[model samples]
Target chain A: MATQDKREDILRAAEKAPLLSPSAQRLLQITSAREHELMEIVAVVKCDAHLTVRVLKIVNSAAFGLLYPISSIDRAVSYLGERMVVGIALNDCAAHLFDKQLDGYESERGSLWRHDLQAAIASREVAQRARVEINPDLAFTAGLLHDLGKALISDYLRGTCAGLLAEIEQNQVADYLEGERHLIGIDHTEAGSALARNWKLAEVLQMAIAHHHNPGAAPPEHRPLVYAVHLGDIIAMMGGCGTGADTLRYPLDQGYGAFFDLGGEDLAAIMLDVQEEFAKIDTSLAETKEN
Target chain B: MSNIIIGIGDLGASKGQDDILKTFALGSCVAVILLDPKQRAAGMVHIALPEAKINPAKAQERPGYFADTGIPALLREMKKLGCQPNARGLMVKLAGGAKVMDPNDTFNIGKRNILAAKKALWAFGLGPVAEDVGGNFSRTVAISLATGDVILSSPGRPNWKL
Candidate 1:
């Protein structure tokens, strides 16, 4: 098939039938590129009580490590800047998009949420190491949203996931991209990139999500962040308590290690640090949920 | 019968025809190889976590578990094998920091493992002559003391040079 037709076919197959809410669509359309745009976005977010509550809670949470409590959107904006506000908004919208159902994957809500957070954190860390000029928040946001398509796929596939798990077991699928492509004709990376485009997200985020699963194949500029998220996902999955069918042992990419100038010693050290930090993050998240 | 398995949370050294270090299923786990060609001595450390600074108690007991602690421990083992830090034939090569789980956001233990090891090595004035890390893949690496050859074996792939 022609490349254009192929894109259409994949886009059509994405299952994004119910478009984003009218307010979200409006928030996405703001292209004034002015300071007032930030106010507009904040205003839209404030109108939704559920999203507002989540935003406030997250802004006040230790993740941001604010010195003083932030009770209002304007304060959060003043403290965190417009980019962080946008990120929180996007994060909130994305989380609300998925249902809590496991879709036979057996991953707990905490496990999934933790996985996303850790990967984003790890991606930002890698960006720092790589000295990539990309925004860490952008990388984090991309990392957080990278696996969203998997949730959609799981929801859509529902009971039929048994076959997917069987294939993973037989082939030892290293990443979800293979399974997504095998069963659904399109993988999560592509699905996520489409979602980003549909939401009118920034180009960097779109690039990161589309190529995160296979960073080596991404365009030159986005490769480092993409690679970071790719590795981050693996770390999160491994650290997670119960990975269920997602626990296939895939081989390490020879180029990926070299890309970061990491020799074996470096690789070993990074694992230790991430694991230790993950324990802390896991604990904090647990406490947050409990409260 | 003598594979000299490098058990979890452990380090091993071998020389001449008597050296073997083997580890299994390293995911978000790190395996480090320190070699001294002149003395024909080689050592391997397979450890989890980065350093004691994150958790001092764990660092004290599992010094071989963090890169900061573990690299020193591996160097000590290499020294026990008569390989000095400034020894002429000393070189380092590394492997095994495959992302075991979580495929999205970038909090990668494997990548972090690779990074911490590098920092520790720099502090010790050692550099990797070779390495492989950071992916959704697992790895098995072996270093031969006699020939100073490192062999990396991975799933769905044949054994080859490190």
Candidate 2:
């Protein structure tokens, strides 16, 4: 009934959320390490026969159009790299959250998956241009999972996306996040932060899920990764891949300038690149889910 | 009865009276609708950016992605349907150029897209007859080739003629 009561109910729902598959948990743990080797990811996949086949199938599955099909898991892991491997692991585990419709956002089924996929690709591209050394793979992983909380909140916000849009239109609230908080006790970022902790996700990832919409508020150490995901989410919206109602309603922190060396022109370039990459993976990953 | 759906960086045209030119979820992207008033042939281009220099290779592959090129590309599509567009006979409508509540966003692409679409139209001795652009919400557009009615709709909002 009350906003706080709703927030508590949402948090309790998150606490009961399904855990990521063991392989996915391992991938996140190793990828977040400072000096991890690629073999660490390969080892994790090797342990899960189902995940191993998904990885190999994606690499050879016309997605890459490899002339010679290599049957080795090690070669497949190296071929697609850590980011795609991480994506396969997580999607295998958390796809119900990723693929669910965001009725609250007025989005249809698969909208969240497409947005997160584009954000993941865009975040990886943005990280590649970071002024300081940072883990681009981790950025990709965080982007893919940043919007997980929206699915959790969608049921509660259903049938009210219009009123929220009007609130944004009249400038009664600064943006959708404000509208979300004003109506509900918490926004997607706060709800997602709870899920990240509930699942015992890596610390940097929790910061990313929490502060992606407002990276400047993130702690100084995790700011670079958070900023990468922040810009990535905006790029996905700009490229016309956002979830339905609340497409580009969040603020883009100008403070990201301190973390990355991207110019206005770079945003356009990243968007085009994201479009190209998204096309390549859209059907390929859909097949992964069906399998 | 039928729809010629245009995606970002994509364009389509139809001479059939049963056709509707449509584009969806236009966040910051701008959709340029061209209808030959006499022939009733219609076309649409979904433009994502103002200029091509940002990615020349992409412009070459999908000219509809940039406003400067998208306007001309849509015009070329109209010509393919054997309908020539003149300043007086052409019905032009522009929709979508929404911001995300951040006025200071250096990349206020919606505004930039509107300006560029206008500049590109003027270069071809054309201008919009009707437009609904610049807001903080995404738009979906449908142009009826049967009736010449341009319907602009936003999520949870009533559809209105542009």
Candidate 3:
């Protein structure tokens, strides 16, 4: 197939990728609202039985270390807090998509899911430390979905893994994304953006997924969120969470530190926090798997 | 046999012959493996940064996060496991410390990590007997307590002894 045709096919497949569940959509809407009313979020979460059950399971999980078993959605929401409840709900919804093996990228089963969670946590931390103007929830969501394209394009790459690896070695391709572009005519960033558009995700999220590898390419309006996700991805990789074949292939954008006015000390602090946060998440994930 | 995973900013040591100490996806970070062929003990530390002075608090909290602190910490733990300091029984191998990105060496964290690992080893009057370092690839390294062998694996590449 011609490169352009292959690109179009991948885009079509991405567009046809599974849409967000109704519960996830509602949770996203509730969390993304400008004004957060706990009651409003609670009402939205209660409408979805699966989301409610999953949220309860998470709160009651051994990792959460809750002192009491919570039987009701209200109690679970109140105990876990609104942001965590929303994150849990969305993660459950998205797990089916990201939890599979991505062998083309040399990722084991659940690697992408773990990476997304780590990046999401890191994004929130970066936003807080950098004092970026974007909402923390938006930054987290964008970070979680920034690599959605990898899931979309995994099948296509599986067939060409051997050849692509050779080309990458022979040409010294900068990273997997560059190799992806050379072999498939479109990179994960573009495919992820397309997936976001198909899911009708917020424009900021689409932009972040599209430009996370190159935040400078993002429009001015979306730069803050894009930059947050970009930094979060790097932080996740550095912390050794869910790294695959593309790990360490992307260069650190030095401009990001200058743009955010983040000194080395600031980054170190954020990294420390990210390590702690990821440790907690990993424990919870392990508990979930055990159950 | 179980594998003890050394995460980023962390280190692990095993005294049991059935245990394998391993670290994965070493990008710019370096994995320092120390083994005692006589005692059949192995230790691995995943060092992310070279110096600790920049973040003294972090260094104090996570000694395995920086080379200066991590190397000494690993040595201490290995000593507890009956690994000696002498050159006859103890063997060292280094893997990772790749400039995976930034061909221009703009950040150069990998190069710095390699240098720091060597410097710290020199403080102990030691050096790597075998090294597989400095490249554009990520590596997974493991040391077998039973065999005292260090193995390096990467994507699209065959696994080999270091």
Candidate 4:
């Protein structure tokens, strides 16, 4: 198939991809609202029994290391706070979106899920370490969904263009993202942004996902968030978290460090923290699965 | 048979004939494998950075995170496994210093890692007898202790001996 035809096919498929559950959509709406109150988030979460259970389980999980088990939505919200509560709810609702083998990207089943989770964790850490004014939860969400396009585009690429992408990567002709553009008339970044927009994700998040690989290209208003997610992606790869064929194929914006006033030590420290956080979550999730 | 996974900033050595030392998803990171067929011992280190001087504290905490310290440390560990370091007895192989990003990337970490690894190995009068380094792909490298066979695999590519 021609690159243009393949691109159009993939974008059309992404547009019709399964939407997030109604509860997850509501959580996103409440969390992204400008003047949301704690009660509003609590009410939204309480509307769904499964979401409520997942949130409570996460708050009481060993990962959080809470002293006492929290049994109620109100207590879970109060203890974990509104942003964290909503983040956990969203994570639970969207878990299935990434729980698959992405053969086009050479990612095993659940690898993309782990990668997104690590990126989410690292995004929050980067926000704190960079001392940026962006909301950490928003950064986490953007990080988690930045690669959503890969899930959409992978199957299409697997059909015929898989060999082309491999050749580009193997021969050092182009980075993976660029190779996508060269062979498919589009890249995951653009495809992901489209999906984010379709889901009614916040504009900032859409922009962050679109420009994560090149934060400098993001609109000035959203650059800080984009930078946060970009750095988080790099840190996650360095820590040997979930990775695929394109794991290290993206370039780091060299100017980002100076733009954020970050030094190597700060990055190194953030990586250590991300590792610790990922380990805790992994252990907790593993235990959850076993039970 | 058992397989040992070497994470970034980690080093592992195995003397069991059935043990396979492997590291996965190496990008701008180098995996140095040393095997002594005579002793049935193999060691691998996943080095993430070129030098440790920038972060001595980190190097001390995780010597395998930097090439400067990791290469020497892995060699010492191999020696401890009753393997001779001389070229005649030990087979050295290198993989996974791939510049997977754009060609114009400023950091050029993959090239720097290879340089650092080469320098470190040369200091010990050792060098890779076989190598599959530098490109735009992530790699998984594994070495069999029993056969001293090194296998390298990348996404969308066939596995080949290194």
Best by DockQ: 2
Stretches off by above 4 angstroms in model 3 are A67-75, A78-83, A159-166, A169-174, B15-18, B49-63, B85-89, B103-112
Any runs in candidate 4 off by more than 4 Å, and if so which?
A: A1-5, A33-47, A59-87, A129-132, A159-162, A165-174, A238-243, A254-258, B49-80, B84-89, B100-126
User: Which prediction has more favorable DockQ, 1 or 3?
Assistant: 3
Task: Specify the highest-TM-score model's number.
Answer: 2
List, residue by residue over B1-162, the lDDT tens digit for candidate 4: 889999888999989888889898786688988878788888999998888876788789999988999988998898888877554577778898776354354435667788899999898888888889886567899888778789998766678898
Q: Sort the candidates on lDDT, descending order.
A: 2, 3, 4, 1
The Cα local distance difference test for each model comes to 0.62, 0.86, 0.78, 0.77
Give the CAPRI class of candidate 2: medium
Ranking by TM-score: 2, 3, 4, 1
Q: How many residue pairs clash per model?
A: 42, 0, 0, 0
TM-scores for candidates 1 onward, in order: 0.54, 0.95, 0.88, 0.82
Listed per model, the TM-scores of chain A against the true chain A are: 0.68, 0.97, 0.90, 0.90
Q: What share of the true interface contacts does each candidate keep?
A: 0.15, 0.59, 0.35, 0.34
Q: What DockQ does each prediction reach against the true complex?
A: 0.09, 0.62, 0.43, 0.32
| TM-score (second chain) of model 1 | 0.89
lDDT of 4 at A5: 94
lDDT of 1 by residue, A1-291 (tens): 443554456576454545655554555454212235467767776787765665566567676576888887777656655434444445445555443444535444544455566676666555556644555555666666666655544554445445665566577554455765655566666876776777666565677778765677777866776777776665555543222345433333444654566543454445456555555544433444445
User: TM-score for the first chain of model 1?
Assistant: 0.68
lDDT accuracy of residue B70 in candidate 2: 86
Q: Which parts of model 1 have CA positions greater than 4 angstroms off?
A: A1-53, A59-87, A96-99, A155-176, A241-243, A248-252, A257-259, A264-291, B1-162
Provide the TM-score of chain B versus the true chain B for each model in turn: 0.89, 0.95, 0.94, 0.94
Q: What does the lDDT read for residue A251 in candidate 1?
A: 31
